[model samples]
Target: MWNTLVSIFPYAIAYTIPMLMTSLGGLYSERSGVTNLGLEGLMLVGYFASAITIKMTEATLGINALPVGLLVGVAAGAIFSLLHAFASINLRADQVISGTAINMLAAALTVYLARTISGSGNVRIMMGIIRKNVPFLSKIPIIGPLFFSQSYWTTWVCLIIWALSWILLYKTSFGLRLRACGEHPSAVASAGINVHKMRYFGVTMSGALAGLGGSVILITYSGEFNGTVAGLGFLSIAALIFGQWKPLGILGATFFFGIATTIANVSQVIPSLQVIPPVFFKIFPYVATLLALVLFSKNSAAPKAIGEPF
Candidate 1:
């Protein structure tokens, strides 16, 4: 069991990072009062954007194309999210309906564009971020092997972003205002703050981060865009709920789901796991999500004014 865990730990972390980014994005959106059900669509947009960008530039830019592709993905996600932001914040449309429309539009639009550009609904990349062990740190006892060895550079980058986000959202006055927009928009407006602008920032940040999550999938384990993130985007939303909308809580929740996912993916090859039905592992995360929601929905620490237009 120890050996198996050691071997699979890196892969679990790899899977967790993208979901973590996406879930964290949801945290921002919901914290600021907008319910962004369009995260799945935003992720798909990033995945498609990054795939095409890398495919077109890899020959000329080599590994340099990876960052370029990621940036393009982020830009695409943010731009695409504006549709949701405008409808929810400006037009005062039903947030859920607007988010659903974003998801539907992204799904059809990305595949159509992919086919138009590549003659198929899929685009493959030739390169990805190479994994490396942190020197010295990797030499530490068990902790080093699991956390520092065979890690992608992107993992550290995302973790740093997560840390900064925690500080920005919890430690700063701006974060308080942002959170206030979700909890009491009228009170914030009475205090002379622009609730609409804060919500816009929150929603835009969610899109940018979700895009980064999608790009991470393509450049890391996935290496291709097939018009879906295999529901990881939705899974991230579940994690957000399960985590109680806090940064540390999200980290733990996503990592748990990631480990569950890795187990399901690798179960066929592992002797001990082979005895358990693959279906069990496959449905574990979703089932757990449902249970978490059933148990916590009433007492959920979600933003009070979430999904309501200011």
Candidate 2:
């Protein structure tokens, strides 16, 4: 049992990393009075961009495509998120509506562009194009097997972002200002802070982080672009809510979701658990989400003035 669990640990980490990135992104946007309903759309853009980048680069450059693919994914997510920021922060549109619009736009755009560029809506890249194990640490017994077995760069990047987010949200003065702008923009404005500007900064940062999550999905898990990225974005939003808008809390919630998701994915393969149908296993994550919402809805609190326009 221990070995079996250890063997599956890397997959759990991989699953958690994407959720962590997206949940952190949600924490940023919601912490600043913006409801990022478009996380799904932004992730979709990153997903497609990463897969397409990898495929194209591999075909043309004949080299490792992971780095370029990740960059493209991040850029695509960031660009798509900018539209949401413009609508919600600059134009003062309804935040929920703006996010929904962005989601629709991303869905349409990704499908159209994928079909146009690749002659199909799906893009795949051959594996082993860019594989790297940790130096000496990867040789460790259980810990190494669990963490460094088959992970990608995304896992480390997510950890760094998580630490940085913790610092930015808790220890930094800028984080204070950002939170102030979200909880009480009028108060922040009275203090001579540009409320709108702060909100915009928060939203953009959210988008970028969300994009990074999408990149992780493309590069680490799927290695291709498809419709799979959309659901995870929504899941991130749920994770953000579940975590009550704290970076560390959100990271924990993401890990919980990731573990459940990983278990669901591998349940069919476990000989001892073969009696569990794959369909039921696949629904486990969603079941957990529903339970989380029910359990946390009353206790979870939003920013003081969240959803109000500046």
Candidate 3:
């Protein structure tokens, strides 16, 4: 049992960080009155660009490639998101339609770009990966083994970002204004705050964090960009809603879903659960997601102007 837990729990943590980060991304956009359904596409852009960067620069940078690659992914996601920002925010286009276009474009564009640049089908990054144990913390009892050992630096980075996001969204003055924009943009504008600017910041931040989340998935777990994020971005959106759009709630929601995500493989590894059909395990996570939404959606209270064009 101990060995089984060791194997599964670390992976659960790995999966949780991406969802947590991306859900936080959605939180920012929705909080500022922009409905961002293009997180999937933005994440694809980040994942592809980061993986390609690591692959292309492997020889020159050696051990330094992934850190640099992360920045490239963030930049790519932000740049690509400009189209959605312009269409939804400036052109006053339907936010859902604009986001849908972004998702479609990201899927095709990443694959095409990857094939063209790498001279092959998929983009893979497999150089100088970092998986390290936290120093003194790893020396603790059972807690250390579960949380601190066999982890990536990326996990720590995401945790820090999570805490910072909470502070930014709840504790700061700008946070109040940003939240107010979602509830009442006209009131915010009347108060002399630039509603448009806040919304822009919110949308761009969503792209940036979602992109970072995608890169995290690649570097920590997948190590390859196959022109798809495997629906993790959509899952993040679910988590955002599941968390009730709150930062701490997002943390808990992602952690729960992350465990659900790994159930298929973990059950196979465990002797007790191997009797179930493998197909059931494969479909369990998504089914669980839908059920969770059904149970929770009626009670959810999203921002008043989340899908509205300001």
Candidate 4:
């Protein structure tokens, strides 16, 4: 049992980081009164953008290309999210429909572009971020081994981003205004704040972070872009709801789902886990999400004006 736990812990953390970042992105959008259901598509766009960029630059730039690819991915997602921002904020289109359209368009467009450029629907990269120990930190006892050993640098980067996001959203006046936009745009607008601009910032942040999440998957575990994120985007949305739209809550929720997913993926190889059917593990996260939603819906802290066009 100990060995199994130790072996899977790192993988769970890796899986959780991406979802954590993406869910945090959702928090910003929802807090600013925009419901960004297109997180999955935004992530895919980032994933593909990173893949193509890394594929083209790796040979000439070596490992440096990895960071470059990540930047490209972030930029792509931010730019792509403008489509949603325009439709939902300016044109006042139904946010849900616009987000769904983003998903469909991303799935189709990425694959088509991949096939055209590479003659294959998948784009593979030759190198990725290497895992390393945290030196003295890895020397700690129980906590050290589980958290610090064999970790990716991207994990720390994401965590830093998460920490900063919390401070930004909770401690800053700008964050207060953004949150106000979600809860009562009229009130914010009366105060002379640009509700539309704040909402646009929120949506753009979602796209950027979701893109980062997707690229993290590519550079960490997946190392390729195959035109899909295996529904992780929707799962991130679930995490957002499960976490009650808070950064700390998002961390815990995404980690729980990450562990469940890791268990599902590795269940076949672990003797104790194998006793339980793999399907059980596979569906556990989604089931838990549904249960969380049902249990928390009445008391949900979702913005009062969320999904409402300002």
TM-score per prediction, in order, is 0.98, 0.91, 0.94, 0.99
Candidate 4 Cα errors over 4 Å, as ranges: none
- The superposed Cα distance between candidate 1 and the true structure at residue 278, in angstroms, equals 2.2
* Model 3 Cα lDDT, one tens digit per residue, 44-119: 9889889988998988998789889998988888888888888988999999999999999999998998888987
> For candidate 1, lDDT tens digit of each residue in 12-111?
9999999999999999999999999999999999999999999999999999999999999999999999999999999999999998999999999999
Better of 2 and 4 by TM-score: 4
Off by over 4 Å in 3: 276-299
- Candidate 2 per-residue lDDT over residues 157-188, each given as its tens digit: 77987998899888998999999887888888
Displacement of residue 8 (Cα, Å) in model 4 is 0.4
- What's the lDDT for candidate 3? 0.86
Off by over 4 Å in 1: none
Choose the strongest candidate by TM-score.
Answer: 4
Alpha-carbon lDDT, every model: 0.93, 0.79, 0.86, 0.94
Instruction: Output the TM-score of candidate 2.
Output: 0.91
**By the TM-score metric, which is better: model 1 or model 2?**
1
